[model samples]
Target: MAERDEQSGAAPGALPRRAIALLRRLARRLRPRSVRARATLGASAVVALALGVASFGLLGLLENNLTRNAQADAERQAVLTAGLAAEGRLDTVLTPDRGIDFLQVVDAHGRVLAASPNLRGRPALSAARPSEPGTVRGTWNGRPVREEHRQRVVQVTVATGSGLVTVYAGTSLREADAADEFIRASLIFAVPLLVLTVALVTWRVTGWALRPVEAIRAEVAEISDRDLHRRVPVPGSQDEIARLAATMNTTLDRLEASVIRQRQFIADASHELRSPITVLRTQLEVAQAHPDPDLWGELVNGALEDTVRLQDLASDLLLLARLDTAQTPPSAAVDLTEVVREVARARKGDRVAVDTEIAPGVTVRGSALWLARIVTNLLDNAQRHADRSVLLALRVDEAHGTAVLEVRDDGPGIPPADRERVFERFTRLDDARSRDQGGSGLGLAIARDIATHLGGSLTVQDSERGAHLVARLPLDAT
Candidate 1:
């Protein structure tokens, strides 16, 4: 079971799995879905978090500073009272300062010696009895005091003639507390408003940033097969958005070219098919009208010829379609030498004397059937034009990493100007449309397309008297 679990990639440890799952769910819930939402929320979240931290830190610093200042003031007053007692004017402490809320002097026995105006003759402000004379202050020092009508007080002790005296001082905390409360309330009110303002600003900015993309999307969506010539708007900024628009236009250009070629192919195929159909129909109609027994065999043979032509034309069309849309890489190892020899053997015993000089080990990577078709097409093309002899050659150019094949014939060679044009579909040299030529005219075109699809090339080369065609394919290095 452990091995199976491991093989299936299950988690290996007992852990806080439920907690982890819950956290993942919460994370997913908090995540914004759209680009615009994510941008706005991310910006707002960062700003809100910063404001919260800064507000907390600033409020804490202010409170600490205010409390320390109040404590320092009380200690200063206590020291001043001790100085007055040393000069025999300790009673002067009864008149407290303006900010002072309370002041009192008590003896070692906890008896009041001097008191502020409002606390005259009151009991000792502190509940703890004072330490004995010459006692070191520790826990024995006066404890914190709280009066019924005032906040807590700070006290200090001083040595006097009456043994040891304690001075108690306190000030109202209302002003400091009020300032803190005001700051807290202000932050509480302003933070949400700031966050809302940030969210609004971020949302608007994100929309503005995506406006060009939206325009491009709308333009692209409007485009279809009917109007592939139209292009998306390109921004003038020369930024990434502009690059995207340019790339999209480039893609549209390719799509338009493909559509045009497809339309031309369909038109050409339809026209070619109609010719045989019309001829077959005419021949059958004439035979039916005449009803002659002797000419029936001739009419049937003619119909069979037309049917064969139609079959060949349809097969060529299907092959072209497959070539256009084929995505599989050609990895079959093919020997060009063998393919050429095979074509030569098949085309022997004809009027054209076929010769071969096939070198050994001229190997390439491609479909064997297509490779054989290429050789067969070339031989057939040569046979049609050759007056006496055709030469077939296959050799390996190891230095160039290529396998080369050539077909040459002693016939009225293709003119330099019409060499490239002959490879077009349905093209023929005989402008008179002679049936004696006997070809669908897609042989060389299909051969060239197959060579190109196999990462190779087929081209017409300059010949002195006969047409020379050369096909080159990348040699299989392995």
Candidate 2:
């Protein structure tokens, strides 16, 4: 068989050895690359370290126990030999039934009087003081004992013709050393295999634990802003991974809603601008065809109206954009009462009966310009719709820590369903209402946005006789 293996170039166990090497290569290639790999490596290293330390400690303890047992047996036999020799029956103690390697009766001068069959006439096994009694190595019957061999001795006061003699009885360590070596060899193979088994188990457990996280990462990676409607898969496990996936889905939902609102805002702004642009173009075309001074005057006046409307719409759009991005309003105190008074005094209400109920010194923290715009929008909205009268009231509600402004007009009160919708951008209840009278549908929207930006709110209130609007703001300290 040896000759055939040499000829074929296939050593014993060569096929299995090659298979193991191939498996090792494949395991290395399939090793984890992400956090899972790191976890597996870390866990496996810890387990291997713990198991190795424990195995080494246990093996050392086993060796010590075996050696101690051997030494104890030798000591007991030595004591028995001393008792036998003291009674002058030393010959009966050297029987084949005795379990020891060598037995000797030596005089004080170190001469062997009686010995085991194998060392009948040899010198004493040991003469000098033992370094570690019962565990030292020495020669026996012209043969050298190994360092691992165990031995024990005792002094016996044996009766003799002239005086007393000391005898040494001991056992060999052949059996104990054999058992220890076997265990040591077994552990040398077993510890590494045990460590490898622990590592494999740790790797598998770590992979199972991180599977959900990897799935979430892959799913999230495929989502983009344009496809925000897509949601990540939530794991059924009630763990951090499940919560993370749920939070991600919720964030996507908000982003989708924001995108939809943004698209709507852009579409409305374009439509509003196109109206004025079309009207201006028509007037210019007519002026160009007429070329008369009186007609030119009318055309220019009409164009100017359209231009003013365009400028106002542009300004409102810009303001809304700024409010959208602003974190806080300007921190300046403005008197709501004074703001309302200024608007009431500047109005040219020749037909509408403007009634004012201004409470003194109602102050709030915000930009003066934005405050004035809020008051103006409320008053203008009322003036446009009121048939005969518009009531404006301002008061500081000391109990509520807020300043309030109320504007009511005796016009068609808004329906309960449309109250909330009226504050949306570019919303108009009556399409037939001329642009000059309705102004822009953005007035209420801009008013509400400014109020909200300044840490206040504008809302419609129930009114039996007219459309009522209320604005509230946090009051500056007294």
Candidate 3:
């Protein structure tokens, strides 16, 4: 069975499947690569198909009309001849009229009594003795005069004085056939020319329309990371290609902004990290050069503090990097009230008093650790700036469907102009605060970033006597 199957070349339907696959591959290879060429080819194919069908239809209609006319002429000629024979005025060699090719008269005994000049001395063209006048196909013998050709023959019977007789008339189809051939030849020559003209026009139009896209592509290809500030040219026309150029320019603008921001971030991070590292290194170097036991402890303490600051800055930088890239939303529900109370309680016994007025059961959906960090950062900022005390408050804004956390301090309030700038990384108000205060300047920035990641916002609002910072997070509906 295996041998027999192999001898048959392939399993049932497998050959057809292989052939179809080969054809598809060939089609793909033959397909034009450029959009303009493909458009031209597609348009040409459709037009050619339409023209071919119209030509065939035209030919069929023309052939049908010509055939009907020929049949009618033959019938009319037969009727006229039959009338003449009935009046006993028939001639042996009759003169054909009205495009009729031949005419014949026969008696009931199957004898040719009279005929047209072309059919003289010839036998009956057809033996059909139709009761009513009707047309049929026959051939003209043309024995002694004209050439043979296909004809439409119409026979009519009439009761004449010499018993019964039949009249035959016919018309040659040579003229109609010649008309059909001419039309067919003309169409065969014209269709391809028309299709070629259409293809050429389509190719030119398609290329013109795509010129803007090509310009955009070239501009983009010339642009690089160092030259992201450069923009693609926008066409004046309000078309899709114009819109595409505009969109490309917009994307370039965003890319350039992102690159600038990244560079600025790196510069700032390096500056921030350098401060603690420089201090620690200098302290170590001075202690090493002096080698004094008395000042060793003091030097070590200062070095440890610088090291701690370095550690904190590194951690803050890492957290910011994660927040920038993190896309997953916080899934766990956390009690905002508890987080605030916990942070405030931990901050007790500090130089500035920490106070809290948290509403119970104020819950939100976010990472609890990050939520605690928000409170911790806000409280730390407040403590560093407060004159005497820091107030932390958590409340549910039912109407807005949010949990609002506000931290306020009784210190010189932040100026309205610097409020937004304060949230930027490594920013510290020189008149109001200093680096000597042991604040990394990233605390508030990190707090704001966490709030944004959790689908919330943190901002400094108007306050009576001190800077008032507010954080709002959506409440956990579940």
Candidate 4:
């Protein structure tokens, strides 16, 4: 295999890389996907680690404290025995104190001079000798003594008739070790139980907190374009989840309004188109039935008129669709004064007398074609409804940073209540302003849409004797 690998020119670490990749893939697959489960597992791992560290530290402190106390007891016992030996009043057999486990006395020659009751004939418990200060303390494993395990031993030396004698006093570590074992066993049992409890609590709490989110998801999933009126359930907690629900409802409201507007627009467009088509079809059928050359000319003219109206309606619909999408930005700086004057000039010979109050050097940022279209539509609307005279005025409102264009006509003025309603597509007031007056009813709507697209506004304002229309566009600073 090695030879084959070498012949194949494989890298030395390829196998290890593949193994690591496989392990990562397995880990990803095994990882918990639910947020609640992940939170529970994360919290458990942290708490477990903290408890483990604290347990080890506690055990260490316990062992140190126990060893210190034991050593202190042993030192005190050894000192008392050394004092007895120095006075030459030592007993051959000594009784141990409540804390001390064993006591023994030896001379400079290592001869055992005294022993405790439990170690009557036992040899010296430790070979430790005192320093120049005549005292020493240390641990000793009780070897050759079948009963004792470990002890804290302290030796003290004294000068007497026998020259130098050493007293060895020791305390067994059985109680401290037993205490440590008991606590270790408790922690060993308790840590896992605590971690499990924490995991269960965390899982339940996280699930409870996310219940609102689940409800929202379910409600949203059931909602379709047709049912945009439905809203997500908002929790009463007034938390981030509640705010999210409110925001979702707001979005749904806007979506519902947009769907309604689109439906209305389609219906209106269909009705408008059907009128011209129906009229044209009727005229053609009449021409086909009569087959009279003299009447054919008038029929063809009427058919042509209906065809023109249909064409105009189609063009208006297409323009409105483009404006609705609003895919492009107005990048050109057009002179509002020029556009107004040019459109007013084209309507010089109209039935209604047209008058212009033009202002020069009034510039705005927008497409010239749309700007002209706004002016043309406003003029057309004014001329169609005007009794005798239509007034067009242009001026720069430097105080408001806008260019204002006003078109007023001496005609039946719009009612205050129906002022805004006039901007609706395919809307016509009573018989006086019906579709028979060569008006598509989209003139005002298209004008308003164009003004809006150019970051401007078009609206019907109060007039004393006739309709007053005003348009405002942002003035170009440059």
Candidate 5:
């Protein structure tokens, strides 16, 4: 209330109002996105990331296992060849068709000792070099050669007393490279299929999640001023969307009540204006002839009073209309205490002894003109009903975050049955609250409208002794 809004000519307060507008825009554009884009995207990213990491891991394991199998095959054959050397049949055992391109035997020195049939005319096998087991890549003659990114091979020489024997056996890295290409191609094709399937599932799930929002929009669109009693469907789930729908329905309920009252106000106002016009017309008709000289002033005065009533009814209706269309001014701090005192003092001449009990700094958010009229109308009603005493109460409830104003009168309180009826525009009670007592009947209507426009409400509080009107305004503590 007191700390609301910035100072005049200063920057406007920023908050949920702006944030809500942005969300509304996003909701509009990503109607699909809202349905599940966010959730689906999150889920899909997790799955995709997991898939990539797993693919790399799985392939590394497969390559390791396959390369081990290839190396063991070469070692087993070399062992068979070593046994054949003892059988004096080494040349017969180390033959073709065992998945080896060639076989060779070498000594410790750089001297060729053996060659396979295919490489007999090619470079001869040299003595084993001192190196760790690993694959190496380079150009073999004029042709390019590639080795495994992982697999390795080496041949160590065993010392015989007179010479050295080399066991040159290990898997070919070139073959491993070819097998890896085939494995990689398989993953490249399979991952897309997996991703595509996941994406489709994501789209479906997102749409399912967003169905409640769609239903709410449809229900809201169907509910217009003519049918404000209509409520948006609430989802059974106690999730965020369900909460949103419930809140919107509550808002619609309030809006519907306000709109209904506005229409009632229009109808009541029509009758109020029509009644006065009829009176004025009758007066003019009676005065058409040579009017009685004594009754002339009284007749004119009566017509003048009717004219004034018409003016007040019209003015009140216009104010309600404006309130319905008016936008809230950027937040402004206002003192309810000052407004109550000013309105009470202005109406003091009517013999209305106002027992004011406003806390000094009681405040709220609203236009000065609108808030002043609320006080004026309440005070006017109190004056008519009060025999000698009317009470004005204004206070800020810090706990509730609101400011309250109450006006009560002891003079013949409104009947229990008609208490709610008095606040209606142009609905003057048969005897006590008749227009004959100077009620335009729009006071309560206008007051309530102003209260609503100020983001508050006006209602009749239950009173055992007299009529009690309560107005509550939500304070903007921006």
Candidate 6:
């Protein structure tokens, strides 16, 4: 019971502390959150700001007008008073109908002679602060006179005996002060209301702006590895964010395609792997059952041959994978004429006819390995079909600015219908003259990929010359 009481008293847990802190921050942001609050705050703030600037301007203007009016009144009255004091018309100047006050007269001795109404011969002019007539503030009658922000006017002139004469006048400013107070009150009241209105409006506008993003995020969240075909929603306009969403959807589409291709490739690889393993196993079983040494040797050779095919297929697969990220690293300024000569020199027996026309200094930019594969695949394909001889030709197409490699076999060529069909993996021509050389059939496809990757082309051209396979490579500046 003591332990439970202690846990509950005078101490807080970390979670409670954090929660309290969060709630405090939230409380600091508390307000009337609604459309009306936002509108009111926004409109009121704009009006208040405009009115504040206008109030300062107007107050200054009104004060200036008051000062100018007072100064003009003092100047006119000073002229009239000066003329009257010169004639010693003191009684007429102090007439009850006149609105002036605190009048005095002075002689050359600096002594007040006849003062009027509230003054009994007091000095009206101060020698210390003398100027042309202007508005000011001071005290009178033992009361706090000349309230702050109120206006007063003073006038002075020379009376008889060359001594100066002075007059003092003032009025209550209750009406003007009250008006200024009302303006301040209105501005103070409106400003906070306007601010609250603006915050509410901003929150609503932000929500509208983020709607498309929220939709895109929700759609993207639903996508899984199994359902990558789904795409993020695109907004109406081609804004930067919209384009970004579209790009993400495009990337999603490409990823989906890649996933599909990878699945198919896996299936294809499994089937290809199964064939060789089956052949090797069958050959080994036959060798084990029949104990004849010659038969065992033949069976072992068959198994070894199947193993070699498997190795070649696996190597090709690995090479293709590498090629995805591989630059043609072993590039050289290779002359196609020299390449043809080397291939022809390395060729065996009368399986192919050697025909060549080497352009003098034609060079191509490509890796030798890929370039060699391009040539070997065409020559081997030609050699397989050609009964009499295959013709090898090399030349430069000056018009096209391309280095051309041509291998023409006199055997039956690809028909116009099937010319595009032979490059696919494991594709065999349906034609009778086509040879079955136990090829994996990925050679042409790989060759085409390499050629294109090297900024060149591999093609079967319509040659009036013979059954044609031509490869064209670019001659970039060395």
Best model per TM-score: 3
lDDT of 3 by residue, 157-235 (tens): 8888767788888888777778888998998899999999999999999999998888888989999988998988899
Q: What digit string (tens of lDDT, one per residue) describes model 1 on residues 373-421?
A: 8998898889888889999999887788998899999998988898898
Model 3 segments more than 4 A misplaced: 1-29, 68-121, 124-176
TM-score of each: 0.70, 0.67, 0.79, 0.75, 0.62, 0.65
Q: Say which prediction, candidate 5 or candidate 6, comes out ahead on TM-score.
A: 6
RMSD of each: 9.1, 10.3, 5.1, 5.1, 13.2, 8.1
Compose the digit string of candidate 5's lDDT tens values, residues 383-415.
887787889998887888888899999877777
Ranking by TM-score: 3, 4, 1, 2, 6, 5
**Cα lDDT tens digits for candidate 2, 240-321:** 8899989988988888998887788999899999999999999999988888888988899999999999999999999889
What clash count does candidate 3 reach?
0
- Residues 341-389 of candidate 4 have per-residue lDDT tens digits of 8888888788998998998999999999999999999898888889999
Report the Cα lDDT for candidate 4. Answer: 0.88
Model 5 has an lDDT value of: 0.71
Task: Give a tens-digit lDDT track for model 6, residues 1-478.
Answer: 3233255463436557878999998976775475454555566677667767876887777656655554455445545555677676665235322434334444444565555555564563444333333334442322322245453444454545454454444333444566667767876776556656665666677567667888998988889999998888888877876998999999998889878866866676777778889989998888878888879778888888998989988976776666656565456777666766777777766556656555667788877676777777777778776767777777777788788787888777778777776765555675432323636666776777777787878888895534688788887576
Please list the C-alpha lDDT of all candidates, in the order they appear.
0.81, 0.76, 0.86, 0.88, 0.71, 0.66
Clashes of 2: 0
Error of 6 at 406 (Å): 4.6
2 versus 4: better lDDT goes to = 4
lDDT of 4 at 286: 93
| Worst ten in a row by lDDT for model 6 | 137-146
